[model samples]
Every structure is written in structure tokens, then in C-alpha cells.
Target: MILLDDVHKTFGSVHAVRGVTFEVPPGQIVGLLGPNGAGKTTTIRMSVGYFMPDRGRVVIDGHDTRESPEAARSRIGYMPEATPLYPEMRVADYLDFRGRLFAMDRSSRREATARVMDRCDLTQVAHRRIGVLSKGFRQRVGLAAALLHDPPVLVLDEPTNGLDPAQIREVRGLVKELAAKRTMLISSHILSEVERLCDRLIVVSGGRVRGDGTPERLAAAASQEREYVLEARFDTDESARGFEAAVASLSGVASCSSSEPLDGAWRRFRVSARADGADLRESLAAAARARDIPVRELHALTPSLERAFHALADAGEEANP
Candidate 1:
């Protein structure tokens, strides 16, 4: 539904985006993840026609953003990180005004207002003043405004920022619910949130895409050897110490290095195991449990996106240094 071809942007001597290229399919949630100053915001702004790219092209649906801003924009709903809502307006009034901005007729405004309020879970506060609402409620009001036109695609920049734990969970759930109906491009600094919500991830650093794919794909692409990291808690300290010996004796495990004990009876260990190019989670769990060891948690300790990102970003830095 969205495409960027060799996009580039620069601010004086600094390149904000260096030859960015990607494609987003319909009805899929793609995460644009990176640390601060990674050109994610630049990419989104250029995609939405807020900032023209220095070179290359941006297409929204079938319309070129640069050539047909109106056609491209009509299909997109954007909610920026710092929500720009009219604090003086009532929540429902704000949505109605936004709908009008989209050229929605009176009847269309009413229907769009009702639909987005329900979508963003702001129906209860429809009559309340936006200035009087909490930060979380205000954020929802802004999202409702963005969705007032019922656009087919959404460009969200830190949609859950500054929210409390409960509020963050609420907003995250709402985003997932919205994703089912529209193509979403979410940009956030929270790794856990991206891991939980997005089906595909695009990790950017230093003006380039460092990693792009499913989590397992990135892990497998970066892993140089077969390795798994496991953690278990035993009945006592002695059981924890012997956990590595027990796992090391397994058929697949070639070596194990144990880490310091975690809180309670829990401890951590890294096992270099032979890979059969299959999922080894269940096998490792079963092996850990056989030695009277109560396995608390087990995960394939493949190299994470964080590791892959560091490798790529570091390479760029050294090359550009």
C-alpha cells in the first residue's frame, strides 16, 4: 500500500535519510523503529508530503505524494508524536471540526465522528472538554481526530508516548485493534512495544535501514553459530549449579556457560547447541525438566535485533568515520 524508492534527505552536511527503500503490503502493520535522529520522522514527513525528499520518490497507494498531494493525503491518516489538539474545544466538537477539514459533509461528519470515537475508545468523553482531560484521554482525542475521515492508512509517530503503564497498554491494544482494518506504519522507541505489536520490523540507524524482517529472520540472518540461552530455577542453590551439567549432557548441547544466580532460585546460562535448523524450545524444555530441575523459562537465545542493529550501525559508523 506504500512504497519508497531510494529516498534521501540532508540537512546541511548531515544526511537525515540515506537511500531509504521499502514496501508495505496491504493490511499489514510495519514498525519503523530506531533511536532518536535515525531519520524515521523525516521518512514519515516526506511520505506524507510534509517535507519533500531531497531525491527519490514516495508513493501512497497508487498516487505519488509529490505529484498528487491531495490524492495521496486523502488515503492517509497521520497522528504525530506531539498531538496537536485544540485544548479549548470539546472532544466531540474537535472531531467534528477535523472531519470538516477533510471536506466531510454534515452527514458524513456525524458518521465519521461516531465511528472514530468508538474506534479510539473516546465515546464516553465525547462531551468533555479536551483541556480538562488527562494526557491519555487527550492522546485518544487526537487519534480520534486523525481517524475522523476513516482513511485507509495510518502514519503514527509515538502514539503511546507519555502514557502511564495502564494507559500505554490501553493505547497499544487500541492500535492493534485499528491495525486489522488499515495499513499502519508505527514509529516508536519502545522495543518491547514493537516486538509485541508489529508483524514486521524495520530497524533504522544513522540514516539507513540496519535490519528489516520478522524477528526470527533477523536473528537467523545474523547468527554465526548455533546457540541458545536458557534460564531455570531449581529447588535449591545446589540444583541451580547442577542445571548446566544436566543440560550439557544432552545430545544436542555441545557446551554451556552458567551465569550468576538471579533473584530467588533462578539462574541464567548460555548453551552452544548443534542446530538442526528446527525449533528447539520444546526439546530444551523437556531436557531441562528431566534432571529434577524446574525449568522456569526457555527461549531460543539467537542473536536479537538489538545485536544485529549494533553490528550494522557500527559498520556504518566505521565506514563513514
Candidate 2:
């Protein structure tokens, strides 16, 4: 639904986004994760056509953002980090105005406004002045405006920036609901929010994409060292070595080691995959059966997203410095 290919952006000497290239497919929610000043905002702006990339392409729903910006932008609903809204305008009135800006007809405007109001939970304050509404409501109003046109793609940057705990939870649920229908890209520093709502995550740092994949996949791919864990219905010293040598022969299996057995009945062994992304669970199970060793489970255990992200980001910093 969205693609950025070799995109680059600069502010004089500052390169805010460098060679960014990734894609968000239909029915998928991708998290754009980074710390402050990591070019996440800049990358989003470029994707939304607010700032043209210095090089490469930004395509939204098959329209090239640079070649046909209007068509591309019309397909997107953007809630910027700042969450700008007309303070004096009533919630309903503001959304109606936004719809009009999209050149929507009277009936279309009404229907769109109603749909987004319901989606963002703005109906309770439909007539309330945006300025008088609480910060949480104001954020909803902005979200409503963004949705007024019913765009197929949504780019939300810090959608929960200033909300209290309850408000944040509400907004997160709203975003999750929207994800069921739209292709969404969430750019937020809050890891838990991203982890909960997004199927995949892209970690950015120093104006570049340091890593991009599902959180679990990224964690596994980023690690140099590996762990092997095994489950078995039986455990014995000689039988263990028989299982170990059988496991080591499997493709990508490096080494299996464990001094003591787990729970005296189950044994846990760690095997380093000789190749990246190799799955050895099935091999281990088959080999154990061949030796009459009752096996239970075997799989590689990778670190968490937080741990993987820290490892990649720290390496990025060291390389740049």
C-alpha cells in the first residue's frame, strides 16, 4: 500500500532521512520506530508529500507521490506529531471543513464526517468547540479530520503523544480498530503501543533504516550468538550425546551443549544455526526418534524487540561516531 525506495531528504547540511527504503502492504500495520531526531518525522512527511524526497520515490496506493502528489496524498490520512487543529471550530464543523477541503460534495461530506466521528469517538463532543475540549478530545478531532476523507492509507506520528494513561489506551484501541480496515504506519517512540498494534516494525536511526522486519524476526536476525533449547520426554547421559550428535548434523546446526539436565527428565540444549533464519526443530525431533530418545520440543530463542533494537541502534551509533 505504501513504498519508499531509496528516499533521501536534507535540510542544507543535515540529512534528516537517508536512503530509506521499505514497504507496507495492504492489511498490514507497520511501526516506524526511532528515538528523537531520528528522521522518523521527516520520513513520514516525505511519504505524505509534505516534503519531497531528495532522491528516489514515495508511492502510496500505486500513485507516485512525486509524479502525482494530489492523487497519492488523497489516499492517505495523516495525523502529524503536532496534531494541528482549528481550535475555535467545533468538532463536527472542523471535520466538515476538512472534508470540503477535499472537494467532497455536501452528502459525501456529511457521511464522511459521521463515519470518522464514530470511528474516533468524537460524537459525544460533536458540537463542542475544539478549543474547549480536553487535549484528548482535541487529538480525536485531529484524527477525525484525518479520517474525514476515508483514505485507504494512514500515517500516524505520535498519535498518543500528550494523552493520559486512559486516553492513551483509548487511542490505541481506536488505532487498532482502524488497522482492521486500513494500511497503517505508526511512528511512535512508545514500544508497547507499537508492539501491540503493528505486525512488523522498522527501526530507524541516524536518518537511516537500521533494521526492518517483524519484531521477533529482527531480534533473531540481529543476534550473532545463538541459543538452542530442547524438550524431551526422557533424559540420560549416553542418550543425551546420541541426541546431541544427531542434532549437530542437521543443516545449520552448529553446536549443542548442556552440562546438566532440566528437571531431571527434560533436557534443554542450545544449537547455533550455521545459517541465518534456519529452522532446526523438525530435524531435532526426527533425529531424537531415530535414537529412541523421546523428544518434546526444540527451537531457537531470540531476545526481545527491546533487546534487539538496542543492539542494532548501539552498533549504528558506534559506526557513525
Candidate 3:
């Protein structure tokens, strides 16, 4: 529902975004992830018409943000990292004000405000002043205002930034609930949360898209080869040497390196192999059996999204350096 096509932005000599591009499909939650100064917020601002891109287009639905900003923005509900709110206003009052800004009629405003208050679980606190509410409640108020118009898309920047554990979980649940009805583009620094919440990820660094895919796909792209950890015990040092040689000779086995010894007779090793969808464990076990080596542990080591994110970010830095 949202598309950023080769978007570029600059402030003085600093290029905040450089040909960054991605799309958020309908009813999908996409995470915009990156380190500091990676242009995530800038991209989000462009998407919501808060800032115009210097080059390329930010399109929402079928409207171009640069050519029809108002129409494009009308379809989006935006919750910025630092929420702008009237401290003295009650939560319900603030939502009413937001509705009026969208030109919602008095009847429509009341209905929208009531729906969002309940949707965001802010019904009990609707009568409380925003100034006296906890950070989490204030955040809920901001979200309710964003949803007052019932837009088809939501752009959320750091939706769980400063909340306590309980508050964070609450917010996460709310986001997930909202996603069932709207396309969402969420930008977060919390890798684990993104891993759990996002269906796809766009990893940016140095104002460029370094990686884009599902978490599993990105991990696979970052890993050049499949790896396994093998631990085995041998009756003699000579037997261990023979076992290593046999494993190294197996088909698809790229390389084998000895790790720290498990004890005097048992040793741990890392086996690297081409990721060709082949089962190398059976081969390794058979080699050990032929060599009379007793197996202690053998398992494939799965790649992690955290590692893939850092690897792509590091690659981006090196390319631009």
C-alpha cells in the first residue's frame, strides 16, 4: 500500500537518504531497521508527507506524496517518535481536536474518538489529563489520535521506545492487533521485537538499503555457507587425526577446523559446507563410525537475524567508507 521508489534526500552536505527504495504490501507489517543515521526516520517522514524527498517518489495507495501530498497523507495514520500532544487536554479531548483537524464532523469525531480509545485500551484513562498520564498512557493517547481518522495505513516510528517491559508488551500487542486491519510500516531499534512483529524487513545503513527480505531470507543471504558444530571422542590422538581427515574428505564439506578440546580425548570442531540443501550430518556420522570415533554432539547451527543485520550494516559502512 506504500511505495518508496529510489527516494533520496539531503540536508546541506549530508545525504540523509540515497536512492532508498522499498514497498509495503497490503495488510503486511514491514519493519524499517537500521543503526543511527541510517535514514529510517527520514524515509518514514517522506512516506507520511512530513518531508518531501529530493528525488524519486513516495506513493501511498495510488497517490504520489510529492504531487498529491494531502490525498496521500489522508490515507495514512502517522505516530512519530516524539508524539506532539496538548499536555493539559484530556485524552478524549485531544482525540477530538485531532478529528477536527481532519475535518471530521461532530458526530464522526465522537464515534472515531470512542472507537480508538477502546481499540488502544485507553477507555478508562480517557478522562485523565495527558500531562498527568504515564509515558505509556500518553503514547496510547498519541496512537488514538493517529487512528482517529481510521486511515488504511499506519506509519509508526519507535512505537515502543521508552516503555517499561509491561508497557512495551502492551504496545506490541496493540500494534499486532492494528496490523490485522491496516498495512503498517514500523521502524524500531529493537531487533527481537522486529523479528517477532514484522513479516518482512528493510535494513538500511549509510542512507541506503543494505538488505531487504524476510528474517529467514536475510539470514540465508548473509551466510555464505552452512555451518555445523561437531563434538566427538576418540580412543587415541591418531584416531582423532584420522577422523578429521575423513570428515574433510566428505563431499560438500568445504572445510573443517578443530575447536577447543572437550577434554583429553574428546574434541569440538566447526564444519563449514556449501549451503546446497544437502544433509551433511549423515556423512559426518558415517565417517566417524568408519573411523571408530564416538560421537558426542552433532547439530546444524542456524544463522540468526541479529548477525545478518550487523553483517549487512557493516558491509554498507565499508562500501561507503
Clash totals in order: 0, 3, 0
Model 2 CA deviation exceeding 4 Å by range: 225-302
Candidate 1 residue lDDT tens string, 163-229 = 8898788888888888887888888887778778888988777778878898667656666557777
Q: How many backbone clashes does candidate 3 have?
A: 0
Instruction: Write the residue-wise lDDT of candidate 3 on 59-91 in tens digits.
Output: 998899988888998899999997778899988
Q: Write the per-residue lDDT of candidate 2 for residues 132-199, one digit (tens) a residue.
A: 98888888888888778888999998889889999888888888888887899999888878888789
Better of 1 and 3 by lDDT: 3
Candidate 3 collision pairs? none
Q: Which candidate should be chosen as best, given TM-score against the real structure?
A: 3
Using all chains and alpha carbons, the TM-scores for the candidates as numbered come to 0.79, 0.76, 0.89
Q: What is the lDDT of residue 186 in candidate 2?
A: 90
Q: Name the lDDT value of residue 147 in candidate 2.
A: 79
On the 0 to 100 scale, the lDDT of residue 54 in model 3 is: 95
Q: Which ten residues in a row have the lowest lDDT in candidate 3?
A: 257-266
